[model samples]
Target: MTSDDVRHRREAGHFVRWALAQKIARDLSFPAVRWNGPSQAMDDEARWATARRLLHDDTLKSEDR
Candidate 1:
């Protein structure tokens, strides 16, 4: 593989890890807010699922910023 390919892969990996951390932070909901809404739990789950799927998707590797 070319160096650009490797660099892209590494950047994608970094973004994936950052997304994972964000997922955790969102899931925790440390400061319980009144506007969280009834769908907060589902939203958090969906966010994590989407992040996980994108992180592992070969198609998304090229698309990650």
Candidate 2:
């Protein structure tokens, strides 16, 4: 790949890592606020957990292909 391609790929990877970190930070702090109600909060927590699992799980990655 060209230099631009490599730089773009690196930037994408950095963004993904940063986004994941932000999600984790939010997830950890979510329990402190109940503005959306407990049920909605629970749903949001579950969604984040599932997303994190799918992103990190090797078995799921293999199955996807």
Candidate 3:
């Protein structure tokens, strides 16, 4: 694989990890104004499901920035 491919993968991984953290933070309602809409509990498997789907989806690649 090329270096660019490796870099892209790394970026994607970072994105997934960041997303999971954000979800956890939000679920905890740390901030006073965060959306409290029918919040779902975040588990390892659920987070992994998000990452798995994200890694396979290129449609959102350009939206990260």
Q: Best candidate per lDDT, number? A: 3
Task: Give the number of colliding residue pairs in candidate 2.
Answer: 0
Off by over 4 Å in 1: 1-42
Clashes of each: 0, 0, 0
Off by over 4 Å in 2: 1-42, 61-65
**Local distance difference test, candidate 1:** 0.57
Total residue pair clashes for candidate 1: 0
Selected candidate, larger TM-score, 2 vs 3: 3
* By TM-score: ranked, best first: 3, 2, 1
lDDT score of model 2? 0.56
Global lDDT for candidate 3? 0.58
Using TM-score, give the best candidate's number: 3
Please give the RMSD to the true structure for each candidate, in Å. 15.1, 14.2, 15.1
What's the distance in Å from true for residue 42, model 1? Answer: 6.7
lDDT of candidates 1 onward, in order = 0.57, 0.56, 0.58
Per-residue C-alpha lDDT of model 2 across residues 1-65, encoded as one tens digit per residue: 23544545545555556766878434222112124545544577888997888888887756762
> Can you give the lDDT of residue 62 in candidate 3?
53
Instruction: Name the weakest run of 10 consecutive residues (lDDT summed) in model 1.
Output: 24-33
TM-score of each: 0.29, 0.30, 0.32
Give model 3's TM-score versus the native structure. 0.32
